[model samples]
Target: MAWTKYQLFLAGLMLTTGSLNTLSAKWADTFSAEGCHGDKEHEFSHPFVQAVGMFLGEFSCLLVFHLLLCHDRRRPVPTVNPGQSFNPLLFLAPAMCDMTATSIMYVALSMTSASSFQMLRGAVIIFTGLLSVAFLGRRLKPSQWAGILITILGLIVVGMADFINLSGREEHRLSDIITGDLLIIMAQVIVAVQMVLEEKFVYKHDVHPLKAVGTEGLFGFTVLSLLLIPFYFIPVGEFTGNPRNVLEDALDAFCQIGQKPLIMLALLGNTVSIAFFNFAGISVTKEISATTRMVLDSLRTLVIWAVSLAVGWEQFMGLQVLGFLVLLSGTALYNGLHRPLLARIPCCAAWVLDDAEEQASAAERERLLANNRVVQAGDDA
Candidate 1:
């Protein structure tokens, strides 16, 4: 089917907002804000605080959700299913998972280049697949398994490039980048758990996607916001840019934001971009195929990398480009998008067409049964 202009707009919104989410957060880290001591400016190193900003952004989703809900109530037909209601408290578990994953990712972003941070998020595909099989009793197709392996290889290549510091940039230590990469991968594990939880527990209630995001945001923000107090008192060796040298100095972060207009702007961008990104992403999945959303995500990664390089945030590395291509191919194959395109090539046409024909035979039946469940429950995964 030909794409509509609105679909194109949502795709662009997804790409732009998703890219900005990472770039703004990374950009925030580039600033030096005034510390509590007032003696000198300190580098912005508050990952926990950043997580709060992200959750706050997510909470804004609730506002739009309610506005839409009110509009829906005025319609002749009600959109909600009475029997599908779920307790709001169930979201806490996934909210915690989101909190942990987002915090670790922020910390990892601070230690690594923005491009690598964006690229490494692809790790979630691997973990989500594995976790779904283990916990959700779902089975992966052969192509999907192949995609997982190829994605792993791509991750290794990316990690190796960072490990070797192929660009030979001495600004960050080798360990920091490696640790950052490891942290990002670890965070994906938690993210996978969150996705599975959402699929199993939340989706069963037939919750609206916007309302779910907003609820999770509310839970995550409220809990993490409270934790910031203790984090301020807990001393930590790393991220010690405040007078107390604690894990996260909320006061110092606030002071820094007050002192540096750019940091505030970055945080504002981070918040606003996240809300819009999630909105655009969900809308894209609804209006188009999830495959389209994945493609847009890959494009977003490229946009982020180009921006990072243009801003001198990181040097260009050839291996990273190769790894991204491999990863992109893996995702495309997993989604069965490559079959149609590959069938055009004379050398591989026979094999690709055979697979395409096989899948097409069952496509209608599977689509009928799985359309609502998969699209509603698994898109975020």
Candidate 2:
């Protein structure tokens, strides 16, 4: 059956959303525990597993793209033709940016609490908005700006609550927490830059988004794998020399994988869901507007949060709930108040079609009137 773009989009959305929710529920407990207590010793023993999971996630994304390409092979997903030569240089900027951002995020998560990770990641929206305006020359209406501010405020409120809970807790090291938060924020900034650069590249070169993603993933995995190689070889004596301790740490790291089947399932589910969600989102954007897609994406985040809370990965703290509502409200306002106003301005084919339809109807009436005149003249004659 021939599928309308909307149908394809909805299918992608369902697949992505379901997988993501399942992944989130599974990973919540594992990430919560590991994010709180994971250390270098535990990391060293099971280095391969860590590397494997990272590799698998990237490979999985690539696999999804390949599947998409195969399904749509009759017509290539739109992309720039590199003219029969592979350009490694073309991949460098995006790959480096992604690698840097992802590496920092992973390291940061290891240092901070999962709750902090969730709350702080919201800052990405703010960074993305600012980057769009500055780098991409996109203008944001005042209401859209307000929405960004509201999201930031909501994150601040959530962070403050986390801070209060951590206050006077000697077990929770303040410096480490701050370091992790800083790393996460830096990652967000890098990601914002990466997204902007990616858009420019795709539009300027007419690069197919899927192909671009595949190339970016390949480069990212290569770069990260290379960089991590040194870490794997670090002498155990330098960090903690006791052979037993080293062996124990390695066992513990391996145990981390086995300890939480549910969390692993959640992580895996999230990976699959994101792949499908992105494909659907791209399809929808082709049919609709990016602003519309962004609105939907925000709604998806709320869905994730709701599911996370419902599954008990997170407690329904009053402030956290309030923050989530505020964030969501901001997104709604941006969509309802700002985007509709922008859409009214004459621009794309969709608007042009409306104007054309009006002109066509008027022309048809004029033709009928002229025809009637000819008939009347014949009668008089």
Candidate 3:
């Protein structure tokens, strides 16, 4: 039996999605193995590694942008005037927000567990929804609001599970974990703001998404690099050569990356993955509706969590699974039902009305031309 076009398309999407997921996993593994987590002996612990990784990742993203621009040039170039080149500064906003958000998330990850990170990240969807409405003047429907509420509830469940687990652990400090959790939540808010801003200014301008991403990466790296120079100047005793602590050991180990083949591989993997994620994400947006893409993205998080648990990178708990289910359900509800229902209102209606108006205008023009010819014929007679 021959497959329908839709079926064929679905098959292709599945393959692409699977490959992207595998690539993401490989990248994460490489970083974990290469001590991208940094060494226990170094003073540069979680925050430092995160900062450095983000720097490298952004640089890699810029390279990918260059590749994308070259590819675009081979196609019919868009009619851009000489002064119409994308302003690098305007593109920097999203990149700066992303770097800040990701950096905070990384710092939080060091303080918390993988499961907590995944669960907490769900808050981003809610923030994105609200930010879209506030910043972009996009209105959300009641159903979307319902979906957001469900997602929030699910995340709360996940957080509760983390709290329970923490209570059972003698080595963990509750205060530190709470602080990290708050930081992660803040990061999600930042990410949401960044996404909304990108949609409004960058994507709306018909900027090639990859080029925009690349510029963001370039600016992010530049900003971080400058900040790090001042950071290096801060008398962090470990850099002063008193190698007695974990932070010192981590810093020392980072210095050894120049000699480690594995570290290089990990860094390369991370960079490649960053590029792939951005490219795939942008392409997917063009192929699928944002609501659908957001739903799939939530599913991807679940897949990541499952894989992490299976690989012993994370410990699975009943509550964690329940939380994941809740979060997933909420996401589905929002995308599948809420968004579609709400779209029927002012936005979709306005689009249809505009299209009808354009058709009417064309018909009127034809009618006027016909009447003009009729009048001319009468004059000749």
- Candidate that beats the other on TM-score, 2 or 3, i.e. the better one: 3
lDDT of each: 0.88, 0.58, 0.63
Candidate achieving higher lDDT, 1 or 3: 1
- Model 3's TM-score against the true structure: 0.70
Instruction: Identify the runs in model 2 with alpha carbons over 4 angstroms from their true place.
Output: 1-88, 110-116, 132-134, 137-139, 168-180, 234-267, 287-289, 329-381
Clashes of 2: 6
Off-target runs (Cα >4 Å) in candidate 1 are 75-83, 166-172, 342-381
Each prediction's TM-score against the native? Answer: 0.88, 0.65, 0.70
Off by over 4 Å in 3: 1-46, 58-62, 68-84, 171-174, 233-253, 256-261, 288-292, 337-381
**Top lDDT model:** 1
lDDT of 2 at 18: 41
Candidate 3 lDDT, 152-262, residue by residue in tens = 999888878777867866644665567678888999999998988787777645465666666777777777756764554455543222233233234443554543545
Candidate 1 has which clashing residue pairs, if any? none
Could you tally the backbone clashes for each prediction? 0, 6, 12
Better of 2 and 3 by lDDT: 3
lDDT tens digits, residue span 55-122, model 1? 99999998898888788788899784333567999899999999999999998999889988988889
